[model samples]
Target chain A: MHESASTQTNPSPRVQRAPQQPKTADAYVVTPAIDVYEGAEELRVFVDLPGVAADGLDLDLDKEVLTLTANRAARGRDRAVTYKRRFALPREVAAENVSAKLEDGVLLLTLPKRAALRPRSIKVTSG
Target chain B: MWSLLHNDTMKLFDAFERQFQDSLAVRRADTAISFLDNGDELVISADVPGMKQSEIEIMIEGEFVTLRAERKPGAFEGFKLSRAERGAQKLVRQIELPCRIDAEAVRAELKDGVLTVHLPKAEGAKPRRIPVKASA
Candidate 1:
């Protein structure tokens, strides 16, 4: 061994990779294709997200905030793209029973209306 | 004097072209999307306000869904476009999914200018429980 291999690498002369830049455009945000419907006791929402998978999707509910995040693998020769959307809950939602499904290229998020938010039927007694 | 007239005409044409391009861009920005979820099913709604059912096409491949609609130029024939702020615009939206869904159960309907798509969860994807039994 003429000299230690570790000494041959010079810190000053070594080339460093550039830091990745953060997205700063509105187009980069995952603008979901959405649909809203009113049912007997709750409101249903459907969000369309293409190229995102179940493992790559994240749904979080904090207080009255509902957040949806999704990541897709790189395709063809194109770079990877990330999509995120946040919706302000109209009222308190049942966080425990919230369910989601992804099929084809659509993301379905089912939010059951809180018991208090649902309309109640009153029984009137004949007087 | 003739050169002056030619320059004025060129300027007018340029202004018309710029206005046309701006309107086209505005139409593209008018696309709106919404997501609704009930415990049983997920509904996706989009605002293709001026689109006809026949003109809209929805396709799903793998985990990607594409929505394409075109408003024919003369769809509103003979109707004066007075103060019309909506319609006359083509809409296209592509969305990605977050989980595997039951493609076979997917259904779509359009009414009152809103497109609603129902996506049900697959049997294997839904939450289930395994019950424990007593051993002898």
Candidate 2:
């Protein structure tokens, strides 16, 4: 069943990510590209971070912000590189239930909406 | 000796030539690659995230190594894109090595999102250490 018309009141939802800023100036840091998708039940995020191992990845979440950091190991003369980015959490997101997975150097984050924010159906009765 | 000086000059010219070719390759492919000339092997690494092993193609001919890969767009069912910075891309890079390598001994591995290739130096191209002997 396709019920997308009534699912989102706003056809286009604006993402509220904060402006990108390097945490430190002394290190070699880069910003990885990311893609965000929105569904009726949850929000999905995909981040490209090639060469970053699972052990070098870190995700931090609080009431307002979500921070992602990853470090790639040095190869020969190339020095170690760091990727850092931050995002502001949406109001309807269920922070406690958020899940993250990393595969083939891509990170996928699933943020489910709060129960109250989900759509509800009303039954009609004859007068 | 004059021969030794001529060899040094030729080596310098070769280095410059390789650098120019590498720069052109980078411009054409828009991809950054790292080439490390180890004592016995050359290690080449490139960032190719969101690509499957089967999607990458490697070709080696003469002294050049070529890499080709493509990244497909991430489209999900029943979902709409709110933001998209990582999109579909196709990359083709042809890099020349500083020395001859044994084509049969080449090894490649993909880990995390990085593709690494190890090219072993050819037997005739490797530097050999010689011992000096004194006789009475």
Candidate 3:
């Protein structure tokens, strides 16, 4: 007889907090795919939002909730659509130091960690 | 006889493996596209996010258009990937138009990771209005 076993990891508590969305039935809403990267100093997020211009992008951070909203214009037979997403920050970050840029329909966001949370090298003094 | 049976069984498994891979390729190549007619011209829009203009290839022949694109992994320096829903992929899609197209006048433009192809209708494919004449 052969025995097989598998274990499932529990979902993070922070990830359980679903994004708050209001009723919007006019235009189609899509949640763009995103990739999150973690570094010693900051966290980087890459969002795939094709057909969105810079003027149609909006980013806001209130408390620990970061929201991203992008509007795509109607083209040919394709109707206008809105891409909206929200994420709860896992760690403290410097709100004022966050930076974002869009290139080739990909949005890159950098969130710097708070000074107290950032890892620093300790210098050793010889006695 | 035993060796011959083994060979036949291996060949059957090889054929099944190839069929399974082909179906997976078809599913992965499903790119979103929209085709529309704009008076004397036709337009095609495809969503190809995170792909550069140079990474996409377009070929048009007669009434058929094919798009090939490759998206590389979005890797960051000095950073570790935490979550990745989108990964490197290769897309190939071929479309057949309803009517003939003017190959010489075909134009394509890529903006914001979307490829738009404008194809003009050929002379023979365009609709013509016939003038009514009263018999004297």
Candidate 4:
């Protein structure tokens, strides 16, 4: 099906840089795509960063800001590319307890809500 | 009878052609836009991932609106880079409004990688009420 006229009218203002020519020694940075899912008590981030190893990834959380940085090497080759992405955490999170893991070039991060931010179910007694 | 079948086949092919074009359109790297209609105000949201606020520009002329931004190259050079992705890139897009917009009343904000532009409809474009008096 064809997209509506309104959809066609709205275009992305972000520009894409052209790929550079290969050289004897070249360094390139690749940014991974991200997917975010929100739960009742936590927010999960899934980043697609191919060719990156588990040890090369880093996750930093400062207050409500979350930064994801990784150094990825192309598969089966000496040349490598680096990827970096930052996310603004919707709510305050426990920076100390946040954890990350890399599996098959995808990095998954789980940000847990701070103890005080978690909603509490109050008990009510009938009079 | 044969002619009727041929017409149906042509229609099917046309539909397929349109679908292919749509898929190609969405294949573009940057792809998210949102519009909000509040009773008297309108908000348009554009996604500009990896772009700094300083690099973005918005212009309005008559009933047309345009957005532009530039993306700079990353620091990594040499060492035989394999794959490089993500970074700022140049982009420009424009839209024509169906009705006149009040340019002076426009407001825009960039936050969390999203750009939102608020435009208020012109006084004449907004609905109005006229009082009626009893006949003499």
Instruction: Highest DockQ: give the candidate number.
Output: 2
Q: List the residue pairs that clash in candidate 2.
A: A51-B113
Q: Candidate 4's C-alpha lDDT? A: 0.57
What are the per-residue Cα lDDT tens digits for candidate 4 across B57-80?
999999888888765643323111
TM-score of 1: 0.40
Please list the residue runs of candidate 1 whose C-alpha ends up more than 4 Å from where it truly belongs after superposition: A1-29, B1-136
Off by over 4 Å in 3: A1-24, B1-30, B132-136
Residue A3 accuracy (lDDT) in model 4: 47
Residue range A10-84, candidate 2, lDDT tens digits:
564333223342333444666667777877688798888787888888898977467788887667887777777
TM-score of 3: 0.76
Candidate 3: which pairs clash?
Answer: none
| Model 1 RMSD vs true structure | 21.4
> Relative to the unseen true structure, what is the C-alpha lDDT of residue A17 in candidate 3, on a scale of 0 to 100?
38
What lDDT tens digits, residue by residue, belong to model 3 across residues B12-122? 533543443321222121256888988698888888877888899999876689988889887778777766656675778889989998988999998987888899999
The 10 consecutive residues of candidate 2 chain B with the worst lDDT sum are B21-30
Off-target runs (Cα >4 Å) in candidate 4 are A1-127, B1-29, B77-81, B128-136
DockQ of each: 0.01, 0.23, 0.22, 0.02
lDDT by residue (tens digit), candidate 1, B71-132:
55333332222212333557678778655678889999864345678888666666667899
Candidate 4 per-residue lDDT over residues A33-104, each given as its tens digit: 555444445555656554455676767676655556666443222345555555554434566677887654
The better candidate by DockQ, 1 or 2, is 2
